[model samples]
Target: MFLLSLPFSLASAAELKFTNADESRAEFERSVKPFLTKHCVGCHGAKEPEGELDLTTLDPDMKSSTSGARWATLVEKLTKGEMPPEEKPRPDAAGLAATIDWAHAESKRANRNFTRRAAYENGNITPHSVLFDPKNIPPFDGESRVRRVSPEIYETFLKDAAKRPGTNQPFSPLGGTTFKDMGDPTIDEPVTATLFRNALIIVEGQTVHTVENGKIVKWNGARELQPLFDPQVAPTDAQLEAAITFQFKQILKRPPTDRELEKFVALLKRNMAEAGQVVGSRYALATVLMLTEAVFRMEVGSGQPDEKGRVRLAPREIAFAIGYALTDKGPDSQLLAAAATGGLGTDEGVTQQVRRLLDDAKTDKPRILRFFREYFGYDKASYVFKEANSGGGTIDFPGHDPGSLIADTDRLIEYILEQDRDVLRELLTTNKTFVAYRTAADWQKKLVEARKKFDAEKKANPEKYKNREFNPPVKMVCEAYGLSDFPEQQPVELPKDQRAGILTQPSWLVANSTTFDNHAIHRGKWIRERLLGNVVPDVPITVDAQLPNTPEKTLRERMAVTEQAYCWKCHQLMNDLAYPFEQFDHFGRYRAMDSVVDIEATAKLEGPRRNQTKRVMQDVPLNRSGLVAHVGDASLEGPVDGAVELMHKLAASERVEQVFVRHAFRYWLGRNESPGDAASLQAAHKAYQESGGSMKELLSALLTSESFLYRVPASPEPNAVPKAASKKANS
Candidate 1:
């Protein structure tokens, strides 16, 4: 889809200072001004700018002005390649690309990225009423979208798409943690490099190279390639068909259409002619590995349109959606069977298949647990670096490392989901916790099994395994917590008074904390947005966000700077919401008092000259109070004593439950919630409430809703980027 229209105000643009010294402004005037004046300013000029946007007077300094957001939106509009009204002269391709790059760079300076902006708005910034109202749904047409698979999902995709299972080097496009949870599937050349490299890697791994004489043909090569690489003989039409047919079964799960087969045959023949038989087979395989459908989850419906101008997704499409939503792998045999029999074309059929996947205890549907991991943000625990002596001086809390805490949280989520009752509420208020815990029996059994394998291998060749120790890997617990040496009790019942829900868990606290202190703002921000369905605007461009680093003052007292008139407008939404978390230290240990360093209290002259000074530690009573303001629901608003109490109050709020539903819709749908999605959102929320908060009931209702099942395509236009093929595996 294209933005088509963007509304910006130039009211403040004229007030900014601009001169020859301002290189950015100078470039804008010289290079960008004419492009805008010709293609944009005619309709968006001072006389009567369309959508209240005056491009002629638009500010160039996007880094420190309100124009940043508008500029970012403009970049999105241009990059979408659908601007210029679709009737006016198209932009100069070379100039257009330069302008987009410049605008995107400026947008980054102000920390506004529009690629993921739509999903963010739908999940967080949209008005709660607009997304949840029963009477506010759009017509029964689906917005076709493509969601990018994550690196993990891509690994699974490779295994399912081709016979290849693993790669030598891990494939990461951005090379860091820059990706948002569910980002837009963008069309960019940068991805071409990542995709092609990985595709080549897949093809190379599958090819078994045996450089013998051409006369020697052995079973050493893979059976799939034997026919294609027959000694000294070119592949025949029948051989090509057989080769494609085998790949279809191994990878695509269904026979390729005649057109698809023809294309593959042509590609194979071309590659064999250009390169030798063995080399050409690898090239042909690489082409198959690069198919966009194998890399991205495509949701464009294939069936014909109905009387209501809606298109129902084909059985295969529905199965793929259900499978991708629930698991990283492709549609299982059962799902494929359902699609083959046309069982996925109806609402009941989709619901039944989804429930079947949910019911299978043996199937590790990590996506279900994956949602809670992202939803709670406990998955980030391992990444939040903390010095050994950051807050609490001692490292007594060594057992509950970030990874273990996240695993414990995952197990906790799975436990709650296993019960499938009051899931959201249970996640917020449960006192059950796992501390350096896993099933000891299971651990011992694994240890014995691994030891046996190692001993057998080492015995087979003692000199070959000279110095290697029998150190087996563990999961969901600390590697050094000594599961083999000292087993921990499972699912220990933490004190209800100290720990209630996941909010009070050590993992959550540590993930949201700073390296040197507790991050009340981050903690508060999570609750305000994730729980209350409210948004806190980004910190202003003009504000210097650093707090006073006075060790004598409490964290709260030092944070008093945010209460200043200039800052409180946004901080008021987060600071108090986070204040309740102060009862827990930066290490997440519950405390009635804060551990602080008071230089005067610990002052001592200890040198021989009696001039050297030392400062010892002291404690101050903690202020663990928080306010629940502007929650929309009057009953849910008030002052709370601690994080647990605040969480309990939030858990009881209907708005909280509805917000949870809205987020789930965004996560599973791989897009933002629209006015059209209100019906689905409302139904899912209602299902959760009516079925005693069963996630099964909620997902069933959501998966079967019109938003997931029907597609209402927009009217065809020139230069519209097809959503399905463009999407990659980013999520």
Candidate 2:
């Protein structure tokens, strides 16, 4: 065990100058022991030590035992006024301060000795501190490095390379907590092997031959690569160079340098000489350029450094950065032209490009939508499974599909983004939403009439309508779902009071809930972490967090078990925040009471099915009273009656808007926020406030900020040579 001796040694040296150990021991016995006996010994003494602390057994000599760390904890608790349980006698202010000071002094001495001893044993010492200051953060040096392309971006790049609308081939999906792909790429064995396999498949074509039951079952036509490889006639040297340049531009978003071009040209020539034309060219394209770092990694910045030890991003890099920030695709022709002419080098030029991109209807604004999906975590709705043969079918909707719910949420988000109003506030409080069915119109009325007539005729004479089919009015749903004609349906507007913003949306409600019942804890935890930026500590390992399956009690009543001191310590921070969402059922349908039901023994046998079981459901009055705190805004932190009221308060919060700005910073920069990026974050926030919370304005400000425009060199060795200088020296 690590031991501390510095404090006692220092005390001894000081005592030799003025006093003696006998006087110090007498003072400790008179003051410290009496204080502990009066205020701490009851719960933390010999008979039954609380928190495993036995203050009575501790040695009076601070450095003789391994008790300095325990002393530090004691000091922290006393200083924070968390010791001396509420019913117990409290320490006087002077006494508390003096004790805390002594403990601190002892802790420092012990820490100093511990550091020296650790360095001697481990060859290094690490600093430990409880305080953090933003001013201590280092500035961005504007260095740039290569990062791998994300899965989505790689697909887009492949489409551009193949000169097709899309290949429709699947790539491996990235995994993370957020729906957004922020995973760092690794050149692991599995990754490289997968890349090689994909490269070969793309170059050759997709083909399928299936045999089943000892028979030749099916064969599909192999995918043709003629469109991608066709040059119309035998290729000339200039034609090959032109093709190489085009491919380079398409994949890398820039032309190859002369050196790179020469190397590739030599490789192409050698391949052509050995294998003739088509086969060699295909092999070269697949194995050489397609597999290079230039195709897979986004390498930004020219090595030229300014006086401030920062480097400006290459003009092309600026264009690609701005383009990728707004959309999944690389820079368009106009952006590339601007970069080529050095027009993208200034703030004004970048602002112009940003505005143009945001205004472009063709630009994939879905990328922005995707950020919100990941930020809110509503996308998890797609994977939620409801049991078909379970008790309490009270919350069931006949046609409620998780995919449709997610799509509806996306539509609502897209609508709000298109309007470009107070984006954060609107998302929190807007009542309007799109449903799976469109609003009823003249065609809808006619379709309804036709459906009614058909139903009547079918009821009267089933045989007459057995072979007949009915068409509905909507067009897009039919097309979207791959139906030959519209289905029978009419859309209904949601009740305004029953719903509000994203919080009440079925996507969020269902995603955060269990199969048969609501998960108030999950809902509250999401709001606390994602919106308010407050972290909830993990439950203790000793605690079993499950609720008892009591048929008589409602979920709220059962959850009241957490009100006990041991459980309430952590649950208090979450349960109150989640209580308000009790207004909505597991399926997000508004309800006045909690559905209570007895689970049949056979319910467990039912697996991964939906809308099959029926059970007697009793209504229990739902207690929707909830408390909201730690939002970092006074106006928004208070008791709320339900989800609607909570949303109203959140909509008015400045902190909510700031949280959104931070999320945007993470989304565009592909990293978390740092103190060095504060200026950019502030500018984005300012733009949102000044422009009435226009998302486009925030994007423009962020894209033009110093953090986005420049980078520091990856290596800072004084004698390190620049890439251009190194190339010249090699030549």
Tens digits of per-residue lDDT, candidate 2, 118-213, equal 211211011011101233323553325455566677676566444323244344434332234442544556666655555545544322334466
- For all predicted structures, in order, the TM-scores are 0.76, 0.67
Off by over 4 Å in 1: 1-117, 120-122, 140-142, 159-183, 187-190, 204-211, 390-400, 439-489, 605-615, 717-731
When summed lDDT is taken over every stretch of 10 residues in candidate 1, the lowest stretch is 5-14
- What TM-score should be assigned to candidate 2? 0.67
Instruction: Name the candidate that leads on TM-score.
Output: 1
Q: What is the lDDT of residue 124 in candidate 2?
A: 6
**What does candidate 1's lDDT look like per residue over 619-683, in tens digits?**
88889898999666788889999888988898898999998897788777766565556777888
| RMSD to truth, every model | 10.1, 14.4
Provide the global lDDT of candidate 2 against the true structure.
0.63
Clashes by residue pair, model 1: 138-676, 142-712, 148-728, 148-729, 148-730, 149-729, 149-730
Q: Tell me how far candidate 2 lies from the true structure as C-alpha RMSD in angstroms.
A: 14.4
462 Cα displacement, candidate 2 (Å) = 12
